[model samples]
Target chain A: MKFFRNLTIGQYVHKDSPIHKLDPRIKILTSLLMMILIFLTESWWSFLIIGFFFTVNIWLSKVQIKYVLRGLKPILVLIILTLFIHLFTTPGEVIFQIGVIRMTWEGLSRGMFIAVRLFLLILTTSWLTLTTSPIALTDGIERLLSFFKIIGFPAHEIAMMMTIALRFIPTLMEETEKIIKAQMSRGADFESGNILKRMKNMIPIIIPLFINAFHRADELAIAMEARCYRGGEGRTHYRALSFKYLDKVFFMIISFTIALIIIINVV
Target chain B: MFIYLENASYTYNLNMPFETKALDSINLSIDRGEFIGIIGHTGCGKTTLLQLLNGLLEPTIGHVFIDGVDIHQNKKGLKEIRKKIGLTFQYPENQLFEESIYKEIAFGPRNLGITDDLLDERVKKAMKMVELDYNQYKDRSPFELSGGEMRRVAIASVLAIDPEIIILDEPTASLDPQSHASFLTLIKNLYQKYHKTMILVSHNMDVIAELAQRVLVMEKGKIIMDSTPRNIFQESVEQLEKIGLELPQVTYVMHRLKQMGKEVNSGVLTIEEAKEEIFSILKVKKSNNEIF
Candidate 1:
């Protein structure tokens, strides 16, 4: 019955903790580094190291473990697909065979490795988003992308769009909840339908939602123009992003973790 | 049917960091054919209370009984309970999505399995109730209508279901004065002619005074006052002002006159009642002056 309740993308849970207090740039860079290193991980011991660090970071973040796990539910299908693809196709010593399908130790191990890697990758990225507000994340992204502006990248514009879209997620979610309740009151059965039937039922919801979204977009454009929102050539942020000593310390800790992970993979 | 909420409470985003208690220890009952008005400031759980009456939400702490039977005891018949108590939400026009007005109004009864001849009859009957011509407008798209007309169509959609009790959440919101008066009259007819147990949640004290026999004033979460409109308006001007609500225009005038040394009853809810009260008080004052 809850349509957008499980959606966690662009959701920021406010908590006053070290991870939440970390510089958004440092948190973004650390997440990117972890994503790359997780793919480079080839052994179960490496996953154990990554998983341990992840669990500790999550604990330090002060967000509920159950809430973080709920964000993982949407990607379960992808994880299962990756696991099965690795499990059945990889060439290895056969442990069991039925006709052309073979179960192998290598396949099982590779499947587990890929599953853990994907899980950790998703977990770290979501953790980055969970700890940082959308405005701060966009600021971090814009700052990082400014280096590429010499190559004619529209970094500020992109960052602004991203921030605006992220800001609308909760608003749109509330609107969708309203529309769903409206339809439900009219005896529109969103649940208890087959796949096709359910999609048909969703038509009642999706059309009105699109109309409202377009209307909102028009109103927002007018409001922005009224405020004289020109492109961000010389626009300065009200709350400027500055790197404090704590940001430097956070960067050092992440660099040390990355170095340890690389050494584990190489050795 | 009797509707009772016993010590009911609700918390949004329960068990999450953003959890909020919207309703708190609300205990109220409505007998059949009673016109009840619920008034409160924004976010004071007036909408939440309306949703609870028809089972749109379940209380986190207490039970909601419809005809002395707990509707949530068996989830199997919950839909049946919903159909029996029609709920037209605020800005109901947003619910219109069918291709034609005919199909739009028929959506509810069709879901209830009324098909063939009875469906047409119900759709036409509902449309006529809202003053829309079935022959001319049935094939027209609901989106093509004016805002006020579309609002009526959305309401007609709910009426097609023909429930025993109808709950409207601010039905006249955002309408012009002319349309607002007509809409209230339409609701009045529905209440008087059909004897349906109507529960209206409105911010307009005048509308509540004009229609509701019983008024339930909500503050924060609980019902602070539940009594006749006369009793509620006559005495609670100061308390209502403290809660960010104002008395009806007529009542406010009478209240001001009473403060200015006139022996006027401050519970007048309409312009006509205020005029009669003023005239009676003026006549009595003249006779006393002549005797002196």
Candidate 2:
């Protein structure tokens, strides 16, 4: 029934904070660097460092811990699967045996380590999206991708598509809820069905949603045309992005964190 | 006592940072076979109230009792309650999906586990109810029909359920004049023929004036006024105007004449009544001039 409420992923939480004020390009770059750091780090101490960095970023972003945690709800199964896979399968010194299944210390540590890494990786990207508005995020992506324009890359087009997609997420979700409610009013029980039955039930919701989306797209294309919206060529922005001192400071802090993680890995 | 909202309140995204109280604690009731129209400004919680009425949304506080029992108390009976009150969303055309009109209209009865001949009967009945010829439009793609036809098909899909109370949210919105009039007529026929408890939500004062026996005016998540449509459109002209709701054309004309110091009844509900009121005054003037 509630689709938009728990939708924290790629949703910008408007809050008065330094992270909110930082340039989107800097935030995007730093998020990317932290993701690489999360992948590279091996030692448990490195995880603690990355975890601390994420906790601080979440705090600075001014989004609630609970809101950020909700973003992981969809992937909770995958995280648990990774942890269990390592625990049951990784060969190591057996701490105990349950009918040919060994509970090894190495397996447990490895599982915990991998789980933490995956969690931190998700936290990094979500933090960027949470703090930065979708428009700014697209602008950042466009600016970063503009470098490839030398090879005739469609950076602006790509960014525009991403911007539209992100902007429509909540709208589409709300429409989806309406369709479900409308169907439910017709005695359509979406819940309490076998998986295949539930999936088949989705046909009623999906076709409407897809058709509505196409209708909206067609209308939007005409609207843009009526407004004389050409491609991104020679287009200027309404909100000109400027990398201020705050963004520079934030950039340096993240760079320093990344260097520290890299040095820790080398050691 | 048929359907009641006792101190019901609904808050969207409850406890979240973006939480909003869409409905304040309010008490209301609807009798059987009553045609009630709910009108309000945008974001005034009209849709939210409709959702609460049909149990699509559970009130954050208080209860929605249907037939003297709280509907939310038994989760299993929600579908039954839904079957009792059909809610047709605004732009119901967006909910139509089946490849053929037959399957689309049959969706509701089919969901209730009705099958084969029984389902076909319901679909045919619904199609006929909407004035869409069953034999002509049954096998045709709902998507291929015109906007108004698609709208009717969508509504037929809901009517196929044969709910005791049918709730329409902005039924006449975004329709051409012909379709709007025809749609209103269709609703009127349903009320007269079936005696279903008809609940319609529309911002159009004319629609409310024409149909609703009782009108509920909502503001800021609370039902501010519950009165007959005539009383609401006439007695509360200034207040309704202040709230940015336009009175019906006839009501507005009558009110305007009254404001101009004319001897006319400002409480007229229809154009015919307004015309008679104005003619009465003209007759008085003509007789006065003759005496002079």
Candidate 3:
């Protein structure tokens, strides 16, 4: 019933910490590079190195670990399912057997590794959102994607759309919560229903949500057009993105972490 | 103290960087059938208080009791309490999603396990209570209705559950003049007809002055004034204004008359009442041989 309240997407917790001060482009790129390294990692030591960097970044972000972990709650089931898939599907020396299910030492290790990797991935991404405002994130994305303009990718528009979507997450959640409560007051039971019944029950909420969303989008488009929003073409930003000295230091730390991850994989 | 709040407080995003204390240590009580008006500036926690009443949001501290039972303590009872305390939120029309108006109104009572036989009767009855034509609009899509009609459908949806306590937050907001007047009249009629305990939260002092027997003024998540409308409006004009709230238009006129050295009753709410007070004063002055 209270699932959406703990939502972390597009939630920016304002802080004056170094992580919050880092250029959002650097944060985005560093996290992307770290994500690549995490997927490439083969050894436990590499995980430890990446984990150390993740933990340090989280600490520097000055966001509560509990708040960051709350974002992982929705993905907890995904992580568990991935672990079990790895544990049972991989072929290796069997260490335990129960009925049709067999567990191998290698499978167990691999499953554990995958679980850790998924957990770290979610953490890193959540940290990026927590430390950076949506405006900065959008600006950073637009700048990063600007390089693809040569290929004719409407980068500014895509970035703006993402930014709008992110900005509306909290508004939509608030709306949904209100709708749920309004329905609940009239004895609408969203919790206890069969799968189909639950989905059927959601019609009252989803329909209104969509209608309202469309209405809001229509209004927004009109407002934007009224304000002469020409979709980033010849558009200047109010707060320009500039990399400070700390952004360089942050890049160096993330590069070092990547190097360590590479060395651990090679050795 | 039929409905009681014991030092109740609510904070959003607890322990997070953006945590905010929406309601702060609020303690108040409402009798079974009292019409209570809650007035506050925007973001003053009026809506949060309404949500807490029906157990939509639990208090971060203290307890909210309905009929002497702590609602949050028992899961089964909380659902029952929620059924009894029906809340029609601000911009209620946006909550409508059912294909037909009948199903939309029936959604509430159906959730309470009312038999299908009773549901048709209840929905029809609730629609009638809101002055909507059950036979005409029942099969019609809710989205096809005008804004005011859609709002009534939403309110009827809440009313179908036969809640003993009805809470409305800014019910007349964003309505046309004619629609707002009728909407308030409909609410007033429903309250009188059912004798339901009603809690109305609004920024319109005139509406609150007209409808509410008792008024609760909130500021910074606290109940700064809780008194009868007459008492709160008549004497606390300056204080209320300081909190960014104004007196009802007629009451403001009375305050102005009093400042102009005319002996006008400051407690007058409606324009009719103001007229009566002014006439009475004029009659007295004429009998005393006062010059015009």
Q: Candidate 3 regions off by >4 Å?
A: A1-3, A11-133, A242-267, B15-18, B115-117, B284-292
**Per-model TM values vs. the true structure:** 0.88, 0.90, 0.84
lDDT (Cα, 0-100) at A195 in candidate 3: 100
Tell me the deviation in Å of residue A141 in model 2.
Answer: 1.8
Candidate 3 residue lDDT tens string, B141-252: 9999999999999999999988888899999999999999998889898789878899999989999999999999999999999999999997887899898998899987
Model 2: how far residue A262 lies from native, Å: 4.6
Residue-level error in angstroms, candidate 1, position B70: 2.7
lDDT of 1 by residue, A157-215 (tens): 99989988988988988888888887777777777868998888888899888888888
Instruction: List candidate 2 stretches off by more than 4 Å.
Output: A1-4, A15-18, A41-94, A97-99, A105-116, A241-267, B282-292
Tens-digit lDDT track of model 2 for B198-253: 99999888888889999999989998889998788777877887878888888878
Cα deviation of A149, candidate 1, in Å: 4.0
Candidate 2 at residue A124, lDDT?
84
Q: Output the worst ten-in-a-row residue range by lDDT, candidate 3 chain B.
A: B75-84
lDDT of 3 at A137: 89
Q: In model 1, what is chain B's TM-score?
A: 0.95
For candidate 2, give the DockQ. 0.76
Clashing pairs in 2: none
Name the best candidate (by DockQ): 2
**RMSD (CA, Å), each prediction:** 3.4, 3.0, 3.9
